[model samples]
Target chain A: MQDLGIRVLLEGNNMIRLLDGLWVTVRISLLAVVISIVMGILLGMVMTLKNPVTKALTRIYLEFIRIMPQLVLLFLIYFGAAKAFNIHISGELSAVIVFTLWGTAEMGDLVRGALISIPKHQYDSSAALGLTGIQIYRYIIIPQTLRRLIPLAINLVTRMIKTTSLIVLIGVVEVLKVGQQIIEASRYTAPSAALWIYGTVFFLYFIVCFPISKLSGKLEKRWQN
Target chain B: MSKTDYLLEIKNLEKSFEGGTKVLKDFSFSVQTGEVVVILGPSGCGKSTLLRCINGLEPIQAGTILLDGQSITDGKTKWSQIRQKIGMVFQSYDLFPHMTVFENILLGPLKVQGRTREEAGIAGEKLLERVGLLEKKDAYPRQLSGGQKQRVAIVRALMMEPEIMLFDEVTAALDPEMVREVLDVILELARGGMTMLIVTHEMQFARAIADRILFLDEGQIVESAAPEDFFGHPETERAQRFLNIFQFEK
Candidate 1:
């Protein structure tokens, strides 16, 4: 019988290493989320462009990003493309690039949905006030769009944080990978250490993601009412 | 038409939809300064179309709309500058849902007129007071009733300080109890000497407040007269029948 008691917390060094790994995971997700939001807003605007050629090009890119698996994307950028193009890409850089690409496609879809959901009369009213194109966007369009996009954007951040665990499959030492390494080292001492370390890692992820989900829900309810 | 004498002059204005169905054909009218003109028409009579064309919202297929001796349809006119002097109110009370009543009123003045925040706020507060909605200045459009929304929309347009105001059936969407409140605001605006053009089905309000009434049917103004004359003795048989239909409803 394995004693899954306070022995889990008896190892201070192990807990410190786990926390360090968790910090790295958070840093990558935060950087990727910011970059993705900026890129997504620009791409979403381009998606709404009236030119057929540009619209078709953006559509193809969106479809490509949607269908490809995130791990596959990581492998392609890290292994396939880097080898094919004779460029050196590190594991961490590849993880960031893959997550950014995935996050951007999803965020861009959110932005487009929010922008199109505004009532048509809003545009007409802005024009009726004799506003120029730039003024309309600055004063009328962006403000209303941002009001709607904030809650959804926060939700996307929580998703991006959880998805960062997938980067461990490609050799980045995130929290999950740190747990794996600890269990492998302790396998001779206790065969069930794998279950204990991985369970701690799962609780760590829950702790990190739950606050953001709560915040988003609260904001959505407050704004909607 | 005498140039430099009229505030606005329309000559044979015509417009058609995609399939070449004419909406306005050979329409002509003129308005002098401070004149209140009411366009009394049934539904889909091109009255709103005529108002939209004068404000440059819709392009005319043929004919010229002259504003202060300059033609608006010449393809060289700066519509934004021309539109700065004209304000319009729609039937649906299209207020910005995300903005407070005060922000909605000040947006035009601050953005278009380049007024400072202090100046815009002063003007906005005064306009809100004029509409009797000063208490609701910080409320969003969703918080207001239908009549309050229309009144805020009116104040927002008035904040532009336009020389001419266009009302496209402003009270058509309000409840019976709410209709008089909006009409009262419009009646006050007319009394204050705004160059106004209105389209309405409320004949009693038209009779009470209109300086001159024009009866439009199909696409043309079949009769134009003062309120007493147009209501007392309509000239054409079509005009007589149109008036008689309303009379039978009463």
Candidate 2:
């Protein structure tokens, strides 16, 4: 264990700081994911409208997000936009904001696919039963869309958790950054510490994401059959 | 206009797609109370479209549809409210797959009509019993056969207690052995004086159940006559040709 340099993380609250940093990543991811789900569902509904203007607008927004990388977005929001717009945003806040924007776009597109996949007859049958527009959505449209969406959305959650690593580049002091700090501080004393620190970080991510993807797979198998 | 004796009336209906292909043109028809009118036509002859128009599924270009002497399609009453009075069953049963058989019937009565669950449950059970599907009330749609699903669809429509029912080839999706069971349910509804307008390819079933058969061709009604008169001696060459596709035995 000493040769592998696991000894460095054992010294001087390094593990504690890493765990605290993990907490930051989890908190930001959870907040952004919750908001993304709520706003994404509404955005998805709007995207499905028959209006050409709304369609074009949502299409542009989705394409912009898909085309631009998340790291560039983080830089734009954290550094460039903060200076230009005169908003004194914190590192954590900037990370959350950038992540929410990315997550919402992905979740909204997922919802749009789920909504459009439902056949036209479902709406017709609901209307023919005297269900109002809202009632049709509440009873028929939403229930079915959710069934088709939940498995895909669960996979998105794991993605968001893994992507939270990028927050370190924005100077958010997340898990990866904490590992780097531990490695830098012990470079001379524990020359091979980088391997163990990075390996521990990898295990940390697996611990968070493995169960979620497994759950998604089980749900998909059950629902499909 | 004074109150007409007809329960449902549609006049001067002209329906066209955005591409300017007209599906219905100047179509006028009326049904008295307790009447069962079966419409027969070649594929794409506006039989289904006419039913869809009456049920407020399709917007009409220039037409008036009145139910119980009140204009329904003139944008006066809400279509959701008016739709309760015009129950429609589609080619596929369209039962909400997530819901059970009883829940599908109860959804309209409970949510739209705002009836108590106890009242709707009793009525739902009775309707299911009438269609001989009481045992399957707790079953989801995927568990049922196609005929069983269509029967549930008819019961679902009937639960709304509409003034008229419109069936757009409700049995078209069923197998040959299954079609009889579905048609028999509609036949029972006809015998019990449940007013309906059916669009079906089953010629024998059409003759057996229709009080008046409207033979349609190219979005126009070529012949509207009593079942015997229309089936025995159709009035127009178009309707005769429409009938010639089938070699009617009985």
Candidate 2's docking class is: medium
lDDT of 1 by residue, B23-114 (tens): 89899998887888999876788998888888887878999988877887897867677777888898888898778898888888887888
Off by over 4 Å in 2: A1-4, A75-94, A188-196, A210-225, B1-4, B247-250
lDDT of 2 by residue, B1-250 (tens): 6688999988989998789999998999999999999999999898998999898889899989989988888787999999998889999899998899999999999999999999999999999999999999999898999999999999999999998999999988899999999999999988989889999999899888889999888898888999999999988888888889897677
Least accurate 10 contiguous residues by lDDT in model 1 chain A: A3-12
Cα lDDT tens digits for candidate 2, A1-225: 467497887888988988887888889989989988998888988998999999999999899988888889889999998899998789889888877888888889999999999999999999999999999999998888988999889888888889889888878888899999999998888988999989888888888889888988887776552
Best-matching candidate per DockQ: 2
Return the number of clashes found in candidate 2: 0
TM-score of chain A of 1: 0.91
